[model samples]
Target: MRKAMPAALVTALAVHLLAGCAENRTAGAGTDTTGAEIPEKVSAGTVIAVGSPETKVALQLSGQIDELPFKVKWVQMSGGPQCSEAFRAGELDVCSAAEVPSIHARWTGLPTKLVAAEFRKDPHRNPIYELGIAPGADIDTLEDLRGKKIAYSPGQAQGALVLRILARAGLTEKDVELVELPSTGDVYPTALGSRQVDAAPLGGVNIKRFTTKYGKEGGKTIKHGLRDDPAHLWVPTESVNDPQKAAAIREFVKFWARAQVWIDEHPKEWVEGYYVKDQGLSREDGEYLVRINGTSDIPADWDPVVERHQKTVDLLAEKTGNEPFDAETLFDRRYETVAADAVADGRKGS
Candidate 1:
């Protein structure tokens, strides 16, 4: 302060001090000097991460998640296969998938737990999956699939459901010729329409489109009256162990249950917003899908859910010649209480 310094020296010294301060500030804010953000500070209560197959409707519909306590990083995926891959790579903490994919995740020794389950409220007529035969094809019943070129995608829910249908009909993989197809929604109908495959499983809006294009007389859906088709929210073992993440998952389930109730109460909004707007379906198609699929509910107890899952696992094991594992062990019941409470609250509000 007393002695005058060279201008060059003073400038260099000031620059060094400023850089050091910047580094310190960045370091204190959980970022490195290179400006890379730090990992979550779970002990200090930080943001929560979530992944979903359907992002627009599942996460942001009707401002359902507008008041979440923890921050969420949403990842969009096409389906369960991608979600399971992401979960294995440590890129996702939680994912929503159908029962078969969730079972496959556990079968592959991935440390994942089914935290919650959603089933169509009208279980007797749950139109989650349908086996559709091509126009003018001779196939009629599940047993009629024999020796036919059926569109199949392994390790997918459609494939699993197909296997279940086959098993029920006293058929096996060898009983039919399976033409492997991409699991994309449109491929099934395309394959069937073009006569590339004799039969395939169709769901959602695709079912409506196929039936409309090739009427029930042209193409027919074999209804098996499947009742235990539950879609689940699966979380990794690491998240299950972490207190912060587990808490967030519990709250997320509660919110999800509330959203399901909202969807039931506001079917027109859901059909229009999700099917017509997000999925780009005609309004008539959207209405038909909603009417056919109906609404879903989260089961409060695990017994019925476990029983249904066991049936799926048993079928998979029998058809694929894999050993059956305990389906109950694959679930973490800690969230059941939270799910029950959430359902109760949702019903009250509805």
Candidate 2:
């Protein structure tokens, strides 16, 4: 109306506005730290981090955690991709996710470092990852999965497990159709129940619910028997460079190890609070998961763990047809001493 702006300038302005809006929209929703002031020291300002629901349980069960040296603002993310996004946006200082995601992050040249590794004491019997088939699907074994549509979330733990399972079966990604989906609570169930996917990888509470709802008659689960893929805690490179934030992370790692001991010691309480009340799973299912899938053991040493991760790197490289990077280089060993002390403290507390 009044001397309209040039179209090019107008479009550029609109693009800028939209990007700003998008950033603002995603800032603190669901598990993020949007508006919090960045602190020079861990004690002076809030440290925003991402973790699984279990992180909440650990914090809650670990009494005296409120007395932490730094203030932590935890955002609960379902899987690694979300955590990676938060890290990319500079919204998260630290995150907890499975091994593959951290490796993927490093592979993509993200400024992140693996601080600690969490292993299951009895991974085979209490495996945290599994692949499940639909109720009426004709798939019985891994070989039968060829050409079938499998629900997959790439770069997460499940995706890595699927690749391993396929490799064990002498198959490749070309052997099956991957139905890409976000690794969320309900996506797996819905995909399987509706027959949208022939098979899917599941973990944590979803595993309990799926098995209970489908049982043996309705559906079946395939255990991969691969336990080298451990979970990890990753931090932004900047945070590691910050003395205060690094110190806080060290303390947090010790607390997390002790929290696992608490969870193992008090399974019933954990089930009641985390599984039943928080996740809406039945008490029976909660108890089964807690007892069967024991808490993770935080290992301070990186050599053995790095060796295990190298295998994973090779697998990913083979599958994706990309050159493998050294897994050892991705790790930041500054926290090893602190983590070892934490493990000892956790044992003493237990």
Candidate 3:
């Protein structure tokens, strides 16, 4: 099992990184904690953490990252449910998840908080998931496929959200046949070409390209039923909102914001370096992937980008008869203060 960072280790990381910032602030900016020119070092700090993939890349690229007040750590998790589990076990500091998982994670008493959003606009989104119908299958829309076999996720995290699409399309679980597919991977290819199930919403790129391979191109798409919208976020909860936790959260956001900017500016590089090399994606496919889903970039702080995520959660909860947790409480806007500070730090350095 992955372990929580030890206090001594956290102390060491914090000091090493904070000392750099202290020195920078001293010789570079000539300022104190409040700009009073105390010239004293930041006393102590700890390791701040978040989920894998985006956060890990962000932290790695963060300039003077180790110079932050804490050692930043990131962990890769399977899905929202698993992340929620780790958080409950006190194994996680900050997590990235879809709006549904955030609500359900909070519902299960995870004491988590949502800080910033990871925006995904269609036409440039990744994995290109879609609800595909079998080759030449009669299914076209959610309503038409009533009584036709369909797959649902085990929990309300990834798969359950699909039901929201169905309900929005004037269909319910009872209206159509319901089947529980093992996972998204299994469900997608099955819906695309097999007779195992009728349809399932999958990431769009594959559906856009591969559906033609199956002679089903130009058919009804997954979005014909579900609207495209903002999806995930980087969240830290009440449990980790202490002064130390707050420091880490701030650094995570500041660095993450910078990383998004970098990715946005240098999508080609990221596709080659991170996605192609690190992820083992073929160069040709890598370029295709980058060209398509390579553009979810947004500013660091929570803005309209994050608000859309909030509305998505509320809408899903209303559809599933689940509770919509308090937006102000879960998605704390106070992180905006930390982001604002980060921007100032950037300007001062420039």
Q: Which candidate order results from sorting by lDDT in descending order? A: 2, 1, 3
Candidate 2 segments whose C-alpha is farther than 4 A from its true place: 1-53, 215-217
The whole-model lDDT of each prediction reads 0.70, 0.71, 0.55
Mark the 10 consecutive residues where model 3 has the least summed lDDT: 30-39
- List model 2 lDDT by residue over 121-196, tens digit each: 8788888877888888888888898988888666677777888888888887778877777667689877887788
Q: Which lDDT tens digits does candidate 1 get at residues 1-350?
A: 12223323432453454454334432432411212222333333445557763533854676866766677777767356787667656667778787887666555545567888888877667668788889988977778888887776666788777777777788877788767676685899888888888889888778777888888558877786555367888876666666677777777777777777777777798777888888888889878877877787777788988888898888776665556888887788777666668869767765
RMSD of each: 16.5, 9.0, 11.9
Question: What is the lDDT for 267 in model 2?
Answer: 85
Model 1: residues >4 Å from true position, as ranges?
1-45, 53-59
| Model 2, residue 218: C-alpha shift (Å) | 3.5
lDDT of 3 by residue, 1-350 (tens): 12223323433453464454334322432211221122123225566555657546544554434656666566776357666656655567676665666655544444556665655555323433456676656876666777776655533444555666676677866677666554544445655466666676655345544565565443445444344534454453533345556555656666665566566666677767776767676677667666666455344556664565567657655544556755655566655445446645765776
How well does candidate 3 score on lDDT at residue 282?
A: 67
Question: Model 3: residues >4 Å from true position, as ranges?
Answer: 1-45, 58-69, 121-128, 154-157, 182-187, 190-192, 204-222, 225-231, 236-239, 297-315, 337-350
lDDT, candidate 2, equals 0.71
Candidate 1 clash pair list: none
